[model samples]
Target: MEANDLRSYISSHKNIFVLRNKQFRDSKLVIDGCNLYHTLYFTSGLDQAQGGEYGDFETVVRNFFKNLKECRIKPYVVLDGGDGGEDGDDGEFRNLKKKGEITIRKAHALSTGRLRNVLPILVKTVFVQILRKLEVPFVQCVAKAQWETAALANEWNCPVLSNKADFYIYDMKGGLLPLWSFQWNILSLLNQSGEKFVRAKEYFVERLRPRRRRLLPVFATIASNDDIHLDKGSLPNWAKPSKGSTATKDIDALFKWLSKFKKQKQAINGVLSHITDPAYSDKVHNVLTQGLEDYQLYLSSIAEFFTSGTALPDSSPCLPEWTLQQLAKGKLDTVVMDVLAKQRTVLSFPVENSLYSSSNRTSQPIRQTIYALLLGVTDGAYVEEYDREELEITSSRVEAVLPSKVVPNLQLETLKDVKYGALGSVLSYWPLGTQHATSCHLVGLGYKRIPNNLKLSYSMVAKAKQQFFRPRQRLALKHVSHYSFSTMFRPCQKCFASDFWVLYC
Candidate 1:
């Protein structure tokens, strides 16, 4: 391809921002199984990414592993196997597909070999290094059932890692966002036999070298699947409301269980102390509580989505075979028939049915000004900008009115509604921390029906957004403090860090 064409390809993928140079890699680094790794390559830039096959694929893999060692962060890769990909190679279908599994072919099919390439080489290479040289205890899982990861992590007494939005759906535990930072979080409460909820940070530290007095209940008090979509009237299900049982029974059960353990208050106080700087602690507590409250509100919002029948699958991007199978199984719950019939267009896509991953709804388009007081905003300027349009601009535009030329005011209103709709639908299965923060962010944005209990407004929403946002200056500061310049672009590291930022950031 021509240089310009390659450049364009790389630029397009830039939005996904997965570029992580060697500098970021260290034995201390823990990656989020495949999602972040894939995004890094696919989102680095349109030109480079589109010509991905042409690139030195193995080198990319090498650099990814190499960077991990240089960073001093123990690289633990989680094998999600979310597709259920099994051995008969069934075109890399779900792992649930056994050796004898077979299926008829469709005109278009994704390759199974490439799927295998996704992990084995990387895993084997990493394992060889750790088991032979690094002498670190690394953990991985390849289970038929996705939920098995939680079970294995619990049994082996190791950390679990994933980035699925519906992690709350399966109640999978140990949540960590690898690219953002080095910290690990316990994502779920489970059937594991060990002490409930080990903090990932402490767990990893202990793994490096045994430590005394490990804290039990290292996780926060998370509200389980409340299925807010049903409550807010989004999706309908056969299960009865879990709230009554949860409130009277579950809460009491949790507290009673806690009483069985000693140092409950002391443990809580110790965690609080870790975040001690008064101002920082206040923010931490605020965020933690805000996250919880959002979960509650999300529970209430589900009613609207269900009542309106808006939570049905989009099915616009499903894999061809999966789409046909869903059709054969009569799984296409809703479709824009006119569009399908008249155009004979492909309607199926990877339906993001998981609440934790994404929501089907859009957002509201209200014009409200939000002042972003960012650490990196030139001179740490606290610019006050009005929402004159619909676009949500955060980068260098510092403070600008919404509904910019790129986005319409109506689009913003629609987006607002979408967020509310998503909260309603996913609240049932999402963790309290995620759900609560989402709700608070929405309420802070002036969503009309948000209850007074949420105590959210545009300012609060901005703060929540800040948790996810990192000013360029802040990231730059982190990079400088963390590593030397020569190590930044070292070989064998993943290539999509730059792309991931553009899309998600």
Candidate 2:
């Protein structure tokens, strides 16, 4: 996720504190549905396409999942489409599967980027349909677009796990910034030792650097309530399929629907035949011909091009059915507004206990603010305002108050522990603010300083007499400010003073 999205997700969620008295519940685990499916599909397809044979798709998926299980993580998986029920027997999509002629290979081929420009809609649809058959309960978020995903995450009070930084940008209330997301995994980064893992992950985290932005409000502004224009062909590749025995049956149904325009055009042609209006007749014939060509091209690609028995139409275009007005909120929720108010406040040393607590029924503004505070602490200092007017007050301007003299020693120890690694050592050898100490630091790695410059060059020319000629190196120049090298080597050669140059040693 981009830094912006991380900040948004963190700020829009409740803070998760290390429980002082009890262990956190396991129920908080939220798995990303789309992300997981994408992982399985892409990995399997790429692996297979590269000619590395794998077992069936189910086996590949199962093995992929087995790795996650070995890590002792049980993430709750959510999906955007209807569920396919258990044993692949029946669910919301069972009837459709029974009525459709879709095969895995044909589906995969039809879903290729040559058609959709590399989009994953077809893959998502396939998984959703399969999951529904397997009885996995997933939901299409009631709100359209990313907000639906964000809203679900908010309702569940869990991290919104997704590979896309865009998810973080959408202001999902109660969305936790997901760490250890699969996107970070790479072969070289994997290590046998725990220490190496820690170092590598720290390095990786440093690089992500989510952009600082108020992303939730921005996401809320763009989400659609209804459909828009099709960047792809009609009939989204992601739509659930109706099941039937023969692929031909599915294609026949699609062809019949497409042929409707043909019938209308023919009727218009028949009516125009009796009229003397040549211009109107010509216009009607042109529209019919164009529509026919488009429909035929779509069909020909599938029915004629591949030379296979599969029956599904190659593709179609679709548009969302809703209007903008339906998707837009009339007024921002008071709770969401309150969360933003807290972001403008001052940071507390020990995050308030109120920030850590979340009830399912309660609005998650407090939690979101706390999470945002935690994220801010990691990136920089947390500055908040209790009132709008106080926002401009800098930390220096705010008066510091002394703590109570009677505060418990244990509490002090706990606070110290929490902030321990937060302020990592400025240097291994010396602390900051020490005079001469900072100057002692070398420009590069610690080493003895050398005050000379050195240069080396080589000269060569082609020789036709000898089958092969060799090039030789010569010292070109030397000057130095300060630098060091562990070791240096050169071919042995004799040096003589100008007066003794006649005598070589």
Candidate 3:
């Protein structure tokens, strides 16, 4: 039975939730097998395309297993055994088949392309093959997959991964949506067991404590089967009026009243008491009382089904102990460290002299501007007229001394009219620590460019001072009295030595 509108109810109260990615590490995840099949069909885009064969299914399932392996997760897959006598007689199965056919016809009308008829038996067969190939342990339940999965999760103390919203009603420790668009959340039980399951910085629910009494389970079973939608108002009569009134309202009012009590037993008792009262007519009272008894019997039968070994089959496949051991090891740390190493390599500045080639000289002004921006220096002349001239003279001298191929085509004139309107355009190319040095030559050139009467704004002056002094500040702290000439060509280090030279001369 579907727990309608339950997910929406839980979402409205979000303080009780935590993400799955933050907590699922090294945890056993129980997957609903049929749910996975349906999720794959839609999410893999197989549903949208024409002429898709069942062979494409293995690739999607393989990728899913690969992701689980990457995350260091141990998964237990459970598939449903057909019908499982949930339907009272043959008529129910016939009715269900008729409904399925109707649904198929409607789907065909709505679909634009040729839709493959994905039967349960066909999908299950493919799934068994893939599971065996991957060496993943799985089970096929004798009855409904939902209850079996829920019972197994409760027994194993793991979370259930399924698209079914009704898992919330089943009181699973967690419900995970493993779709592409799924967010991380552990829909935990409110009591102490839930507290132990959540990770640091994750949240837990205090309000949704599960009721343990037998009668409350009956209430849950009735609520599950009944088509009556629950809202704020559908509560019992005793919970309605403030301590005195005997008046009764509809199911909506009854639900609202019952919600006030922390325990479901109290609410169920209130409901029972209200319906059994002498104020009601004998015919109505007898019918209501009999319905409650029937509900109790139905609840008992369900309990019997769960306790019976036949209902929940032990269908878990045997796998090698070494394979199971491999699944348990956490690999996220290694993956994360590798990612960090790559990032460090990318962030490290190119220190080689060959990078100073004339072809790269044209990129200097933009690089200098980005460095200046990182240092919070905005008003400074990023490429001073003198610096340009000095570069040109140096390039000419080098060209006369060395072979033509050795001299780079330095384009100092290109930076003459460049303005620093926004550094975002070029910031991506700049290296880490590019902003630490103070280019006093650029700052002095900037000072010279400003008109005497028209003073630069405080923000502009501050940015310029910060850009110019930050590098010197860093160098002074390091006890480095002089900057090397080789490092001088780089913007961050260039500022340091140029500033020192300007100070000494």
- Residue 496, candidate 3: Cα error in Å is 87
**Candidate 2, residue 324: lDDT:** 13
- Give the poorly placed runs of model 2, Cα more than 4 Å off: 1-27, 47-56, 67-74, 81-126, 129-136, 141-145, 171-180, 183-216, 219-505
Task: Return the TM-score for each candidate structure.
Answer: 0.24, 0.26, 0.41
Error of 2 at 306 (Å): 42
Tell me, by lDDT, which candidate is best.
3
Please, what are the lDDT tens digits per residue for candidate 2 over residues 352-419? Answer: 11122111112112222222322222223332322111112122221212122212232211322332
Q: Which one wins by lDDT: 2 or 3?
A: 3
Off by over 4 Å in 1: 1-31, 46-51, 54-57, 82-162, 166-175, 182-505
Residue 158, model 2, lDDT: 46
True-structure Cα RMSD, model 2: 30.9
Q: Model 3 misses residue 394 by how many Å? A: 93
Local error of candidate 1 at residue 403 (angstroms): 61
lDDT of 3 by residue, 307-391 (tens): 3422322222321222122111210111111111111000111111221322223334333432332222334322211112211
Better of 1 and 3 by TM-score: 3
